[model samples]
Target: MPASATKSLRVAVLADSDTRWKWGALTAQRLAPAGAGIRLDGYLLRGRATPTARQLQEVGVHADSLREVTGVEFLRAMTEESYDILVLALVGGGVQAMLHGLRHAWGTEKRPVVVTGYVGVVYEKLADGLLLRHGADLVLANSAHDADRFRAVYEGVGAEASAVTEVALPFLGGAPYEGEHDPSAEQGRRPYTVVFAAQPSVPDNRKDRAYLLDRLIGHARRHPEREVLLKLRSKPGEHTTHIEELPYQKLVQGQDPPANFRLVYGHMGEVLDRTDLLVTVSSTAALEALHRRVPTAVLTDLGVRELLGNHHFTGSGCLASWDQLDAGHRPVADEEWVARQGVAADGSYVTAFDAARARITELLDRPGPLPPLTPYYTPETAPGYLPGILARHHLGPDGAPLPGAPAADKAPGAVRQIVRRAARGAYRHGVQRVAPVIRRMGEL
Candidate 1:
């Protein structure tokens, strides 16, 4: 039975710097049918990969609205506050922190249900899939394919198979955002625009990005009537880690771009509307463009099996050799494939949401403590190990306290502001550089 109307369920979403806004908004809506009987709080994790205040602002979420919690604070929040569930929005990666934090926080006491959602369909080898499956109470999948993979991973490791739940990729849930730039509505008045959605730092994909951009630029130059746009992962000067990759900004700096060539930076949902044709190595944007009925192509020039396992689009019929696209062939979508992938804008995708809601309701009725950590990590020593890990990373409750020292009181005025900034910078640096090595050491 659902919690009584008099007592609302307290749900906290554990979001990283990059995902807080979307998850924050989605969790509030997804749980709305439960009405005023639920309160959703977005807590930004600030241990290793902390999201900068500026990054959160760009996501349109006010920094103040989110509760910034370190591992220590997170543990404290779980015990002190009456949260019923903690949605681990960092499922694919960074989930290890949440698992460790949970063990440290709850110790022998019951912990809130830990749920996680999938980000996409592409299978990047999850080193800790079993660990995550063991730790997470329920892992919401994006599709049947994802659910199967998730299930196989856990079942392969002799963990519980019932933990996987098929949920539509959160973005696909609810109503689609109707953007202003509809290609069909504009028709002859607007130039035919080809947009290439950029991918992250996959070395093989990054190496050929410049070549791809040049192809599009060359095509635009030859056909001056058409326009070509490179939709960047982030605009230059944005506090994004796209710098980890070869940024397109640097790639296009000295090149002579034609008048028809432009760089676009916006939500892919909006950009796809203006886009008559979309090209990408293997981006989730391909899924979006296909759903929008926009012509889309998955580039396989470098080598399909070698570069990216974009075989997820195999049925889409939009895969093209770079030479084919260079010859001005507009790739066509395979309706059969679209339906199979559930990217079709029809009501069919909603079934995933139905299953998700059903699973969530079931969990709400039977909430209890998390399982022993020994099943996933160093259960026997997690509590002891966690404090030292937190201290090493300067992730003490009040702010990175010096090792073995108590947290200092917040300094007054300018001193406080300066101190916080320096600490945050150090946190980001440690997460980017030191955390990985330390984590690997722990595994060893």
Candidate 2:
């Protein structure tokens, strides 16, 4: 039997009509296996979804088609359902639409949304996503980078969010990420090798990855003795399915210069262990490589600017881009660094899992009816009733707007260019959004 209901503490997982929405929902459901008595609802807003209310089939499992609701209407439902928790999945444009939809779904009846997404350079996205999170009771992040970004956005919006996780290694029953593989399988095999994880989502985004892989193949070809074991990660949904129908090991050897790249599709724990030098575009597998003491490097792209920011050591040279893929570019990560990644045999993701559990529990226990988050976002000085509107409410004191922790910058326009590029990327990848503001001087 299901757990007792706690006055309909519904968790509405919004699936904004993007494949990303499906991906995010699957991810969250996998991560948060313990909803306890809290009800879980999955609402997908396809073009013709019906907005009819049906009995939640399973106590915490609800699947519905949100008929014809814009992002705003969807958000407003928080007030309608009195949702205790609103979990926003990372479907690029879904957020802006949802916020616009919920223009009036406030008062004590609304639910808090734990909005999450990648926090790269999407300034407005980071801004808007944070604003909603600020409005919602909590925000969960997939990575530390995201957590910190949300923190800034929330603080900017006059709210605070509990840090979720830097890397979301999931647990089934509140269990640690023991990673479904055994050491005996790895201990009896391969002398030295390297595995790389590749996830190609957006078409253009994968170009850089293809280029890097090509370069690696070239480097490997030039040196035959230094066996470079390449493990390709290409599972649909789990990662990007760029090579959708490409048969596993089908891309292995004799295709062309870069054509002979290795491939593995079903799953990837043992492959990760066998890897010597983990390489990729921007997949989080490098961290796994690090934990495994496998030296790592990005194919050198602006996307990887976050991790490959600087040199690890003067002569160590653990990080590099395609431009620096010299046959001599091999860098070694010591046992200590790999241990942190859970690589040196004793390393497991258990600690991080425990920490994540604690965080979720704390968020669940926090008092509801959080202060309104309007005053911190908008600035004072040249606004009419706005300042008064923000202050008259129970909102907290104003602090500096959490100007999104810029990716990297010491000057002007650089961050803007990056953030704006990201915003454009979000739009380009089929993300629906409220129309951009038109700034011009035209005839009336």
Candidate 3:
């Protein structure tokens, strides 16, 4: 435990989507020193992917206080209240905007230690995303491999690299998989279950998504005795961390699935409890399955491409095709490879966040006012790029709220709240229904 174990801490998390909320909330709990009382306040950033009530409930993490707020609104709240730490669980643009906004808002006043990082595999937008998140006090890396990559990116760009800290995925905790041979025998034994975790936008096109769906159905038909589950991240019309231009639910509509096959929704951890074989095309659920010692596979049916993110598992020894899986192929994970990925299947999971906790504690114990939040991209450094990012959050070049920006201190009336919900519903309708139709029309 760190020296700050005796101190109580107030932490605030600002997240945009369900996955990020899960990551940020769990991370806050893990970062707190053992035996320290923590007051967690959650701020859900309002946007296209902003989680619905159902999504929030599925995440199953409760904070002392939780509310929805716009980016500028959040900045105002920070000025009115105080917290020991702030976890920015947002996209690169959002993090960058908040860093600048908070810099101007706090202005010489003591500020919280800001932290941010990816929710899962850092397989896309390596430089763009990392640089946007550059100014954070700690840019958390979920693995030693990620820590090295993060440092290299920062040092290569001549930016400060001290902020990159190694930590494991905070959400990777569940009962380890027991042996396949059930000692309890047939009377109490459950059927072998195969779960295919679906991502929102990995195989973005209809053809690739349809092909994967067909394969899942075929697998179900072949293995009649096994329970085949399509574990969906969100329901139709609901958005997650990523946009789903082509949802599996929609693609599976015309097919006649076998009785043994089903679409399951809820927590991934709960689904993993019954999973004998976990399959995916680079969903982060693969990491969760690996951490629990479950037999896992990253499909090569669509090719090992960066777009699919399966390229990240090149040496994991868990990459295999569905055809091989149907022939009873179970890929054995390489232990050294697993360790490097921070899966912690060997009971090393308990100490994964020690460094993060120690660092937070040390920062809290600092004597006087900490220096201003200095981001890598200033007006002089990224004149063209930085302005657009801040404008999206209603912030100006100097981080002050723009003239037309909504006043944060003003509370919306009953009619305004109703209008806001209706607008969001209309926006989702456009994404899930209208946009696909337009795309199909263009192809025609």
Q: For this target, which candidate reaches the highest TM-score against the unseen true structure?
A: 3
Q: Rank the candidates by lDDT, best first.
A: 3, 1, 2
> Candidate 1 on 253-277: residue-level lDDT in tens?
8999889898876556667666777
Q: Of the pair 1 and 3, which is ahead by TM-score?
A: 3
RMSD of 3: 1.5
Segments in model 1 whose C-alpha atoms lie over 4 Å from true places: 4-8, 19-28, 31-38, 47-49, 52-64, 91-93, 108-110, 173-188, 203-207, 237-243, 340-344, 367-375, 378-444
Please give the lDDT score at residue 333 for candidate 3.
94
Which ranges of candidate 2 are over 4 A from the true structure?
1-10, 15-84, 91-93, 99-103, 110-133, 141-193, 199-213, 220-260, 264-274, 291-293, 301-317, 321-330, 333-444
Residue 434 accuracy (lDDT) in model 3: 89
Per-candidate Cα lDDT values, in order, are 0.61, 0.42, 0.93
- In terms of lDDT, the poorest run of 10 residues in model 3 is 179-188
Q: Each model's RMSD to truth, in Å?
A: 6.2, 12.8, 1.5
Clashes of each: 0, 16, 0
True-vs-predicted CA distance for residue 315, candidate 1, Å: 3.0
